[model samples]
Target: MLKTAAGGSFIIEDTTEVMTPDQLTDEQRMIADTTRDFIQGEVLPHDEQIEKLDYELTVDLIRKAGELGLLGADVPEQYNGLELDKVSSTLINEKLAKASSFALSVGAHVGIGTLPIVYFGTEEQKQRYLPDLAIGTKIAAYCLTEPSSGSDAQGAKANAVLSDDKSYYTLSGTKQFITNAGFADVFIVYAKVEGEHFSTFIVEREMEGVSIGPEEKKMGIKGSSTCPLILEDVKVPAENLLWEVGKGHLIAFNILNIGRFKLAAGSVGAAKETIELSAEYANERTQFGRPISSFPLVAKKLAEMNVKTYLLESMVYRTAGLMDEAMREMDNSKPDAGVVAAKAIAEYAIECSINKVFSSETLDSIADEGVQIHGGYGYIQEYKIERIYRDSRINRIFEGTNEINRLLIPGTLLKRAMKGQLPLMEKAQALQSELLSMVPGRKIEGTLEQEEHLIAMAKKMFLMAGGQAVQKYQMKLEQEQEILSHLADMMIQIYAIEGAFARTKQLIEKRGEDKATIAIAMTEIAVHEAFEKIEAWAKDILATMETGDMLRTQLSILKKLGRRTPVNLIAKKRHIAEKVAYASKYVV
Candidate 1:
């Protein structure tokens, strides 16, 4: 029995065991394969032309994607969708991301722009809008950002004045930098109502006084259509209101959460694409009479890129599997279904935010490295890395900037702590102790349990000090957003490690120990590394807040105490790359 911080035992098992490819269901593999083929056969060929904003060609391809069941993956079958689980959706997004900025357009349309309606729309709204959206009859867009509110999407000043008869709301405002703006048939617009709360409305393109301005030339993702949505006194019927009035934040937050996971998945895709490109180029482009990939520095970069991709892949599917399984435990058919649904879904926001932060940063770093390996050829537009570099830039900025996500990370986890959503720190510690007993390695030594204790302490510190911290240390908190960001990442990795470990235990019981060896290796590496990171992050956090030299002394002691087993990462990465290459797909 696994005990939590509060000292209760649960049936949850340690999941740090290894898994093999045969462990994945056929459905999972099929969706991943189909997505890979789509990118290689379809999008890659037309990428350059699409980057030029070939609107007609892009729409045509989008329609083709609809026909291929690439769009509306998460929508229910009753609503003209495959009704695939979140894992499938995540896998698709990861593969698409390999195409780089093109993946951003795909993600925005399928994830942020369309998912709100799928999750929260009325039956009438779903019937009227989703079939076309699912089948790509109409492109979809989300209009939450305004010229004034970049990060504060809820700060929408676009006012929707209700008519005296309560029949319609006249909306007149502009939503800026909207993806698929010029091409979408429908939009989920956020606006403020007079004497009421901020709300979301379903605004159709055929409505009166609706138009899209010229596309804004962006720093990246040129293939995507982003423009300002001009709603000049557009009168929307009261029935067009999505979900309940004043609950627009629900739609926004839930959809954005899913978007974060998909973004992580997509970034994994981009990283894989970048890796393949770099690998091929390295083998062909020779320097010092050998392929550039043969150089130690280039080799090191490729290895690191592969490691990052593998970790991202592990985190994404693991999170998706958890989401899908959790959703299955709920009743999703009630009118108030999404409320309970939100509870279950919202529990994983920490995971989603972590995926967003780590995957985006990994993609950015991988793209830069790919360019460096290309040795000047990477700078030229002739090389794909230049565009990939540009396209990868906006990922960290959008889908709730990493800054906002960082705060949400600790904030969300703290909420879960209060609600007992996670087992108490003591329970988590007991599990750690049990794992250490089973593995019995030097990596398990040196203040691991203490580090976990510090994490719990940190959580308590934040809770006790958070309000006052915000008031007295607002500027300091803002400046240390990076700490929150790193802590969020550490939390995410910890969750993934824990969950994956539990899953591995299940596999071992059902399929025997031999079959789970590889997963065991992966989990061991992941857990130790994650522990080190969390240890470092927690220490830094403590040190950062301290005014005395005691922090430095404590951190130095902790650091010396927590030494780990050295991994032959190069060998592990090569092994991973070979498997992915053999499948000719993104393995994670």
Candidate 2:
């Protein structure tokens, strides 16, 4: 029954089989290696030039990537693409992160900019655009964020009106912070049709009245072009409309679902790079008559960086695997595979949001630690960590602010539960009665069994808190932003811990317990850390929602459910750090 539930149903379902790093196919590895080699050979050497806003060099690099078929993982083979699974696409993004700001350019072009057409375009539109865009002959940019609207994307005031002859639509608007706008040849612009119907249109740079403003300076990712798109009476043919009229939100939001997941993958890649940089710096930099890595504080930072990176990597691939599975179930004989895949990715909106928030934050922490490990040198632009830290901050702001994403995590779950897409209500009801008569504590057995138990209890805690909130507010639960945020935190922790736990369990099963020591330690560390947060958030939410005897009863249940023997993370972290320091890379 749980297996039949939709995406983000992992909160209730048993751990579904996932594709871990160890499970990458030979072909996938080849693709990853190609991407890595491309970055090292073509992009890294130009990092300095890229930082100087050399658009020509950046475009050349993108064209080189396209020549290698790196830009078309999500595009159909008929359109000169590899038509690879979501895993391959994720791998490409992850590897590209090594290029920093250039990665933003490629990600924008392939992900949000191009995916709209891949998923929502008509045959003629695809024929006209996909080949060139897929092969990097024509670059693409997504235009959804306007001068006046961002998080409230539907509030865009861009206007598109049909011509008297009905041959074209006259569009007028300014799209702000448009990635790749300076060099992009095609723009997937969102506007209101007849000044009322929100819709999407494919506008070209060559079109009359279409121009780009001067590039804006930014804190990071300067290599990627960011300019305001100016559209003044630009004539877009009616045939260029994407999806259905008034369904622009579908194109905007669904594409963003994939964008969020891809952003997570990119974050993982960036975080891993930061860890390697920090580890190497610690190994080379001397302090107190020894390498700084020999110092406990420095080692601890390295260990935390490695642990968070591993956790994020696990979740990013897990979500990608789930989307791939869903995509695989669709009938390829139909012409709607793109639409099906978009829907599949959209189904896991909560997971995507969680991955986006967690991975971005994790990367930021790793980047910050990387700088700290570099000492005073980190504050200078000469250090790579400084750029990484600056680049990492925007991930949380874009792809939906972490705050908006936090609200959506719980908000979307409730919507799905009410729609019977996720049997959350049924589980919540069952958990209610179970909690009422539940025993105080239960013994867990075997390797990582305690963590497994904690994960299950975390889910129960979420159900309990969410059910109470729903019961109290009924239809008005959206008003309680604070409670919703707490619930989101609980769900995020549950997903992260369980993702790590499941991946480690699978690894142990394949390689035996002795060989998975680092994984086991990492899993334990992540679960315990997440469980602590979940406990604090649960108490805060319950305290605000319930009082006196009721609060006491709920708190008692939470304590019993969340109870666990403390983990000696210092020892585990030391072990993890030792391994990473020796390898000078993220081993686990």
Candidate 3:
């Protein structure tokens, strides 16, 4: 869905042609600098106090962020917002990671909280609520989670019955773990009207029978509010019905797509912060009469962390670029602007889920290693990495659980194939024929040729594994959760590898190979690791799905596709660690 305007080419067709962080415009760079400066000068100073569950301080900072237009990046200028591009907001989310618990408040307010109205609200709704939301005079919270429903969103028990006079709707239900519930002035609540059709309503804090429960003790992000929103006979004006009845799922799923992408961006920022902290700590703590950073194993951990961060950051900004390009040609003046925006976001749903899973898992691994790098200090709450470690745990559960997202990946692609929107079946069929007579190896040529070839083979692996699974299970593939997850893993690796490799190729074009040495090294390392994972997953799936002669034939073809010359990863990791250890941060 994030296709380029030129012939509507998807980034997967040619990632070198897509946007990268290095391709930021002057305005984007300026906004990025402003966000960084604000985080450093204002947010960081009170980070400690902010994490103590200080609601007033959190609200005040959000208003300050509003004053700087941080909360309005996705809003239209007519609504008194900055109306920045997707990349700009991605940068804002990345920068906000440094704010710790405070980041949660701001992200919730800016993303799911406020974006519903920005995209789906009618003219009167926008005029009435947006100006205040844009400048932080009012804070909005989304109410989709119910006590009995988590991943099964459609199973919500919230019910809203229309009044006889049709003047309002009476809402009664409990929304669990609602972000910003303690202080939110407005709520984007989802309920079924007439106990049948799913829908949404805009409920106000001041309405009768509206109440906020006591904050739940949380493992992390304590500075951000987390409380249940109780709606008992709460009357919402009929005009506050969002976009019409039975279309609430549109608002819920579309907003989540955007939320997943933003979460990935924030993870990139958090990962960088972890690396910097680990590097600094490694350099200061002496062991065996030398800093711990000098050890080969510690260096290996740092390099691995840095490589994952690079891959995640590359995929994230590339996605932001895709979204911005798609948004540019839309006619927002039309009344269906909200619907148009929802469609646009839904188009890239696969990419959003990919980033969410990759970014969350990436930060989790980095955080774990971060604790190891700090030894005993990492276990203590006095250490910031400890807090980061705790905070990162929730991201996997946010937007959508990683498990649900993993299944959604291949499921979505297959749906597109059936709908004639994607040529997945055709490509897989072609790959089956190509593998029948194709030779095993290719000669390496120019810069990044190996990585590029690896990415191509990985895509073929996904197609082959997924194709065979479909042929075997057909319509029942949805029930094969393990196979689906394996297919998703391959695709996730393909996306990350292609995105990172493309960005590296772009940098090489502009700065030459010698200057892009580190980027090249990181790309190659990630590509190799990802290829191995794809290989393992393919082998497992093929073995499980086939038998006897057919299994042997499939394994033979996989061997041809997986053939490659191995590199001395140990030396490269040490080289990467040397530079990061010297700079005490992730560079390039």
Candidate 4:
């Protein structure tokens, strides 16, 4: 087990070990290759048709994926699933991202749609639903967001009233923006029981009064089913109640933790494809008698894309490893293994939120640059980049908008601190005294050592700003959304940079420095760049909280902590880009 703080203390904890992609087992690599091949061979050929809203073809492809056992990595073997580790499930999402909207269909079916039952359903419910869902014989859809409820999911107006005879619950509501609604045979619907208790129920598509509205004309992922699911007094058996009534928020929020991480994995995969597309196009398209990829500007863009993708990949796997560790520590021989696993995933909710926000924004940037690299052709629907660009937009909006996620990051950490799950308050108080007498000059070591020190300083910056903000606002800190958002940005940067740094250090330790040169270079670049952003965010946040001499004192401390000699990032990026360009893909 890695020595780290529980809950969200990683922001203030020194990380030493993190799982990297280079450590993937042979079986995991084979799974990834198989997924890549399936997408390339089976899905890419029909990408055009799928993009044109060919629902049947999309459904067929999904069944084909299920036949290959791609859809049930997280489901148990007793349910006809592979019952693989969390990393395997993440790899599946990463590779499926190459399939575009088709990936969304599979993700919705396997993630939010079916996981509710897998994690929260009774044994009978699991037996009834998991087998079909595992094999893709019956598709599943999750209904939580309503027309009036999105980020505020618990505020849904949907209602379900139990019948007088206690045989069934009459559900009446409309769930909007439902993915997989068009073809899903099973629906996990959230409603207020008796129009008072918020709850979840499993409703079959064939149930009376259960109907789906017309397909939504979406901005992207057109092939994936998106529509409103209408439940008009639909009778759901008492047995269909998932988990406990009035505790539906537990299921809803916890499942989203896994969904957010998997979504980040998918974003990494999509960003990788975009990087490849951009690189291949840049290499083939010559300008002024040379390949445009040869230009410094284009090379920089490709390098930056590779860097962000690599960083996101590192964070995703690191979080997966943490979840795996948590799961491993549980006594699986017990009957509550599923609940244990769910709690394990929830333990890193802060990390999940960070992954979702960072990876989504990273993919959006990559998609935008990919379009720019292709110039006029990129804007046209005929090219893949245009669709990818559109598809990337929804990632930030869905799975909880990045704004909501941003707030959740710091907000959750503070809550955990108060709850004693993390020693954040203690660390903050200690750091406050240290700040009063802190010295400026400090000795630095090698590149990686310097990055590690910078990360520690970044954490201190977070504690200072966050601690002051809490004291200033007291109970009203939630209303200071702007400060919370800035703190979230700082935390996100710290996690990304620290994750990449820790992974690269482990790679170097295991493979020797010579073998990990590119990893070192990428880590150096990411750390330096992220530290700059952290400095700026700290300044902005402090300016909001304090002014005049108090502000000057805080700024001086932040400046000292952020002080570092800048490296030739352009040269490092050039070296990194050379490797990616030569391979015509994301080599790092």
Candidate 5:
């Protein structure tokens, strides 16, 4: 029997259910356990030497992962893949993150590097490329980043000129910082076509003028190949072109959105690994004649890390599950199904960006504290914390920098909010009214009244920032981006509080109202604290818009919101952490 965990249904042992092993299906659990065993037994022991770029060992491990089915989580059944859904694929990424750089290599191979063809390729292309990718018979690489086109990838300088016969595209350009460039048998190369649109082609190692430069030393993930791909008039057959002409951006953007979400899932894995490592260390390291884990400060850090990790994991799984459900409901056999689905996938750019930013920042904070908990050992090469700290830093820099993601959140939300697409603020109003009704005379402070005020301020800010993204090179979206990003974050906290309370109410109803003490208390705390924070942010925005008497009026509302809110969040978080930690992983 299969057992499911989290929100997914699966089958597992009755005893394991008590331990909260619901986050994984039986198949996923087996794969994760296998990967974990391999990492501990094979990878961790050689992690130091591998970080030095031991090519042979790295290649061998890639083969090992292939043998274990970690390399083809997304491939179809015919191509030797498990044909799993996005949630299972995310589960694989999470498992791989336990090993740091090794996970990056594996994730890139299965994610951004190879997914374009899997999602958009013709039957012939799938027949030709996916098997090798699935079995690790040949390495794969994604070529998009260039020296000048970091975030501005549309400004690709790589020229793909059509041949006189129009049967081939002569690709000429350099792709910098390409993963697996040194050994990849195939590369998904994107270049600007002569007619003004970007195009994608599968550039094989056998192709003439296809060459890789010596690997550039990276800040981290050194074991994975990273170098420049030079295609000097490399001719790729017309059949090799991915999707339609001028549609490379669609493929690139959509695939990257999926990649970003998976990256968040991977970061969640790394966070869990860091927490477990730190916990193990703290339990053994003595301080004041007792384990350091006994110290209040150290325990608090661990608790905080656990709570954030649980939060991130919950978000990742929820997003992935939603994506999987959407894909399942789509009519994939239809001629336009792929294109339609891709568009819908891109619609989640905001969700993916939010997850990416939150997960990466959370991992960075956890890894930093993981190091702190290890004392002197963390900074030294002898411990994995040193590499984790280094490897985790790149998560924020790549797959669209967090700065880019931050802007994406607010910009995406505002467009939807203004169009009456998402009723976030409206929902917030209703919740505020409900809670206030329950706690009479609470003086709700910056309630719906202030939310309306901020909405106007947001509209003006959007106008001042101009709705355009400026020139192809300028980042004029910065100011609007900051405001929107901050607003979206506040919105997320508000929604989360509402959700927590709603769940608590449901649980109380199901299990009998008397048994809902902890859940009720926690939900109350979450709502009040979130209200206070939202009010503060709303007032801050108002401050910038008005002055003197008007500012004082707005500021008073914020102070009132903060006055006498019930719920002690510190205690609630401690309880939440205790619940999650004892549940093994991702229980809350």
Candidate 6:
């Protein structure tokens, strides 16, 4: 029998239930409204001051958010934290994106900086740090990237040596691009122990010889602290060592997984805000005696922005649902709870990467269109979209660059298939057999039928391209970064198509087809656009990987699978545009 949801399971199974904003409980909604109120009532009023990098003001805002229990969602209650579910935490971040730079500060502290202790700290360590960190009395920063290491984390040159009496470890390292460095009271620093084993240690800012470099003048997200931490033989107590020695990869990579997901949720929030700003601007900005929103060309941009964001929002929350489910039974008090939590979160590594890459790109593209919609005013700093445009650029680079994430999507799947943890090989084999007898243009039935069939074909397209790639390259497929990236694109599109389709179905189920008319239109547009990209990428992969009769055969199968029922995106987009324009905000 097929199992319940797991990482990358959507490729094999149909998702019947998903968590959407519509399904959020009243309490979760309240948390969001509270955060929204805080951002609007407190943060935005200080826009100029924040933009000026007012350290005290930024830290004060974070402390206020902490007082509201906003920073403690991922922390367990035993440590004087809120211990909310993933959905609630996601909502908080999403609403917090109303202030982008400040959002990054809060996200870093709540996610990467502090989650290490929440999930991996010794009980004593948690007792010493969790309460203060949770309440924002003490800010925390993550230190992993070094001057010599960026994507290649293990290449870090930082090291720590224990004293002969074993009382403390003398840590020496420079941590690059550390968020909250200026105000962080605690630092989760990584160094190779005994000059060999990469490990994590909790370092205090007040520790002797600990220093912070001047802030980096960034192009955007400037309000958030971005500085380097200088540890000149800082003495970190032996008890401050996190988890076991040499297990730092577990902490670094696992925390990055959550960081990616939270970044995804934050992108969705930013993208939505961009759409709201774009829609309102297009409606209010007049062109040639008519509102720009009345123009079909401008309306089309609004529609695309609105629809793409809808698709991303669906996926972000659904992934959150998966995460919450995975950790539902966790016993945080268990001595091995950290290991257990890490394993549970690691299971969805692929999904988290997917969410990260897609959401970041979605926000970028939407931000671009938002600027275009704003015309020349977008270039001026006075406009919110200008700041948004700049701030959005950092997301792709923040939680592992999108290129790194793209490579991970397919590479991770192949690794799992080789270990029998995933059924990729089995499905690829089955797809090849199906291609022999499968006819092109087979019609699917029910609401959103054409979109549904396209999703099925997209999955087959992935297997066809992937199966041949694996057969040819074997273990060396890792070297084919381009082909692997293409395969990852297929996986992304498949997940995205299915995400939109599932959410639309839920909308129709609850509201009836009559009421979910705009949702269907948006899903149709997103599915069509995504499938077109999938077809192009598959052909690109086939051409690059094969030749002669083999290449021709693969293309032939792709053609059969790529047949479309012809969605009228122009009409659908116009309809969507009207919906958002009327509300002057992004709607379903």
- Predictions in order: lDDT: 0.70, 0.90, 0.89, 0.90, 0.69, 0.89
RMSD of each: 5.6, 1.5, 1.7, 1.3, 7.3, 1.5
lDDT of 5 at 399: 88
* lDDT digits (tens) for residues 1-588 of candidate 1: 212121111112233433222356799889889988988899889888888888887788778878889997977777789978777787788778766656766777788878888778888888888898898888888999999998888778788989999999999898999998878888989988873578899999999999999989888888889999999999999999888789888778887888888888887778888888787787788777977665666766776676566666766766666576667756656665545555556657777787888788878999998899888999998988888888888889888998898788766654554577655444434543443234323333331233333333333323222322333454466466766665565556555455445554556667677675544445545555666676666566656665567556545544543544565655655555454334433443
Question: Which scores better on lDDT, 2 or 3?
Answer: 2
Question: How many residue pairs clash per model?
Answer: 22, 0, 0, 0, 10, 0
Instruction: Give the range of the ten consecutive residues with the poorest summed lDDT in model 3.
Output: 5-14
TM-score of each: 0.83, 0.98, 0.98, 0.98, 0.82, 0.98
Q: Per-residue CA lDDT of candidate 2, range 273-371, in tens?
A: 898889998999997799999999999999999989888999998887887777776775467877887887788999999999898888888999999
Task: Report residue 173 deviation for candidate 4 (angstroms).
Answer: 0.8
Tell me the lDDT of candidate 1.
0.70
After superposing candidate 4 on the true structure, give the runs of residues whose Cα lies further than 4 Å from its correct spot.
1-5, 331-333
Q: How many backbone clashes does candidate 4 have?
A: 0
Q: 1-588 in candidate 3: lDDT tens per residue?
A: 345632112322545666789988899988888888888988889988888878888888889888998888988888888888899999999998999888888888888998999888999999999998998999999899998998988899999999999999999999999999999998999999988788988888999999999999999888889999999998899999998899999889999999999999999999999999999999999999999999999999999999999999998988888788777889878888877977887888999999999999999999999999999999999999999999999999989999999999889888888888777788889888899989757589767788788888888787888899999999999999999999888888888888888889889989998999899899989999989999999999999899999999999999888988888788889889999999999977
Of the two candidates 4 and 5, the one with more favorable lDDT, higher being better, is 4
Clashing pairs in 5: 2-10, 2-11, 3-10, 3-11, 3-12, 4-10, 4-11, 5-22, 5-23, 410-484
**Global CA lDDT computed for model 5:** 0.69
Superposed model 3: Cα runs more than 4 Å off: 1-14
Residue pairs clashing in model 3 are none
Model 5 Cα lDDT, one tens digit per residue, 126-203: 889998888788778889899889888899899888889999999998999998777778899888889478888888
The lDDT, on a scale of 0 to 1, for candidate 6 is: 0.89
Pairs with steric clashes in candidate 2: none
Query: What is candidate 3's TM-score against the reference?
Result: 0.98
